[model samples]
Target: MWWQAAGILLGAVLGAEVLGRAAGWGALGAGSREGHRVAVTFDDGPSERTPALLAVLARHAVKATFFVTAPASERYPALLRALGVAGHQVEAHGRWHRHALLLSPWREWAQVRWHPRAGGAGPHLYRPPYGGHSPLTRLFARLNRRQIALWDVEGRDWTAEQATTLAARTLERTEPGSVILLHDGPGVTPALLDALLTGLRDRGLEAVTLNDLPTRRITFWAGLWRLASSYGA
Candidate 1:
C-alpha cells in the first residue's frame, strides 16, 4: 500500500509537469505547420540602440517582432516607423514595462488599447511584461482580439552576458517553429547579434516575425485552463 501511494504521487507530479510543458509549447505556437522557422522577437524597445540592432538585422536579412511599450513607441515614434519600414513586426508590450499581475483589469485594458495605436500599424500580438499572465491580461487579450505570445527560446541578452553564452543558449533551445526572445538594448550589441545570427544561419534556421507563424489560436476555455494550470503549478 505504501509503495502504491508513492507511485501514485510520482505519477501525479509527472502528469503536472507534462501538462505544464504542453501548455508552454501551445503558448509558443510550437504546433505550427510552418517548417524550420523561428520568430525572433525583441522586448522593451524601441530604444536608442534599436537603430544599431535594426542595422544588424538588415545585414542578416532577418525580420523580427518588437513588442514595444507605449512610452517607448511615443518617445521614439521615428524608430517605430523605421521598424515598420524595415519589414519588422511591431506589437504591444504594455503601457510601461510593468508586470500584468500588478495591474487592475481597467489598467491592463488601457495599456493594450493604447499601445496598438501608439505604433501606426501592427498585428495584435501581446506579450505580457515578465512573461507572467494574469486574469487582466487574459481579459484584455480576449477583448482586444489579440494573441498572447511567448518565446520558446531566449538569449537572455539583457543580463549583459557574453555574446557566446547568449548564442549558445539560444541555439541549444532552438527547434523548428521556435520563437527566440532577444533585446535591443546596450546589453545586446551589434557584435553579439552578428554572432547569434551567424550561428543561426550555420544551423540553417531562418529568423522570422510572429506574423509569419502558422495560425494556431487557442480557444477561450483552453486559454483559461492553461492559465489556471500555470498558476496552480
Candidate 2:
C-alpha cells in the first residue's frame, strides 16, 4: 500500500514536469513560422548592467522585452522607466526571483498577480523564474490573465563562456520564430547581445520584441522538443 501511494506521487510529479512545466500547456513559447524573425527577451533586470544592454540594443536599432522582477523594478524605478522610454516592452518576472515550482499556492498566486508600478503598457506576459511551473502556476496565470512566456533558444550568457562563443552557439541553434532567453544582470550579456544582433543581421533575421513577434500556440511536439533541449543547458 505504501509503495503504491509513493508510485502515485512520483507519477504525479513526472506528469506535472512533462505537461505543466515542459509542455507548457496553454503557454506561448515560440512565434509563427512564416517570417525571418525572432524575439529577444531578458529577465531579472533593471540592474546596473541594463543601461549597457540598452545601449547595445539602441546601437542595433532593435526593440526587446524585459521581464523585470518587482524588487529590482522598485529599486531602480528610473531604469525601469528608461526601458519604457526606449520603446521596449516591459513585463513581469514575479515579485521575487524564486522558481514557481518551489512556491506555495498562495505565494504563487501573488507572484502571478503582482506587477511593477512603473511597468509600461504591454501584453500580460509572465516568465516564471527558470521557466518552471508548479501544479497551480498555469492556473494562477490564467486566472490573472497573464500568458506564460517561455523561450526556445537560451543564450546561456550566465555561463562562464566568452561572449563570442555564446553568440556563435546561440546563432547555430536559433531558427525563425525562436524566442531567445538572456538575462540583463550578467556582465557578458551586453557583448553577447552585440554579437547576437550582428549574427542575426548576417542571417537576415530581424530581432524584435515579443509584442511584435508573430506568435502561435506552443504545440505538444514543440514543447517536448524545448523540454528535451533545455536539459544541461
Candidate 3:
C-alpha cells in the first residue's frame, strides 16, 4: 500500500514538472500518435540566418511556424510580415525569448502583445524559452487561450559536431507528426540550413509549420480557445 501511494505521488510530481518545463501539460512534445503527422517549429528566431532558412523553405515551397521573441520580431517586422504573407504561422516565443513562466499574467500578455507589433500575429501560440515555466504559465495560458508547443526531438544543432550528426539522426528518427528540432541560430550557419532543408526533402518528408501537421485535431491547449470562446457567448 505504501509503495503504491509513493508511486502515485511521484507520477503526479513528474507530470506537473513536465508541464512546467514544456509550457503546458503536453504528454508528448511534438508528434502525433494518431495520424503519424509532424509539425516543425522554429524558436528564438527571425535572426540574420533566419532569411537564409526562409529562402531554403521557399525553395522547397514549404511553410513552417516561427516562434519568435518580441524583441526579435520587433526588430525584424519584415521577417514577421513576410512569414505571414507566405502562409506560415507566427507565434509568441517570449519578449526577449526569455524564461517567461515567472512573469505575471499582465506581463505575459504584454510580451505576447509585443510580438504582433514587433513581427506579426495570426494564431497566438507560446513556447517558453529554454522549455521551463512557472505555475503562473498555466493560468495565463488558460485565460488567453494560447496553445503552448514544445519539441520532442532536439538535434543539438548548437554544437559543431552535434549539428551534423544530429541533423541526419533527426530525419531518420522522424515520424509523420514528429516535431524535430534544429537550430538555425548562430551555430547552424547558412551551410547547415541548406543541408538540413535538403536532407528533409530527400528523406521523402515535407517540411510543415506547427499548424501544418496533418492533425485531425489540435491539442487540448489549442482546443481550449474554441471552448472558451463558445462559453463566453
Most lDDT-accurate candidate: 2
How does each model score on TM-score?
0.78, 0.92, 0.72
Deviation in angstroms for 58 in model 2? 0.5
Q: For residue 202, give model 1's deviation from the true position in Å.
A: 1.0
Candidate 2's residue-wise lDDT over 125-178, tens digit each? 888998877767877988887888888789999899999999999999899999
Q: Order candidates by TM-score, high to low.
A: 2, 1, 3
Judge candidate 1 against the unseen true structure and give its global Cα lDDT, from 0 to 1: 0.72
- 2 or 3, which is superior by lDDT? 2
- Candidate 3 deviant stretches above 4 angstroms: 1-16, 22-37, 101-109, 112-123, 187-189, 214-233
Reference-based lDDT, each prediction: 0.72, 0.87, 0.63
Task: Please give, for residues 1-233, the per-residue lDDT of candidate 1 as tens digits.
Answer: 99999998677545433332335333445435348677778888899989999989999999988989888888999999999899888888888687655677678787666564544544577777767555345556767776677765677787868888878877887777777777767655666778888988898878788877653555455555555655675
Please tell me which predicted candidate would have the highest TM-score against the true structure.
2
Query: Over 4 Å off in model 1, which ranges?
Result: 1-28, 31-34, 117-123, 215-233
Q: Please write out the lDDT profile of model 3 over residues 111-142, one tens digit for every residue.
A: 54454533444445677777656546655665
Q: In candidate 1, list every pair of residues with a backbone clash.
A: none
What is the TM-score (0 to 1) of candidate 3?
0.72
Candidate 2 TM-score to native: 0.92
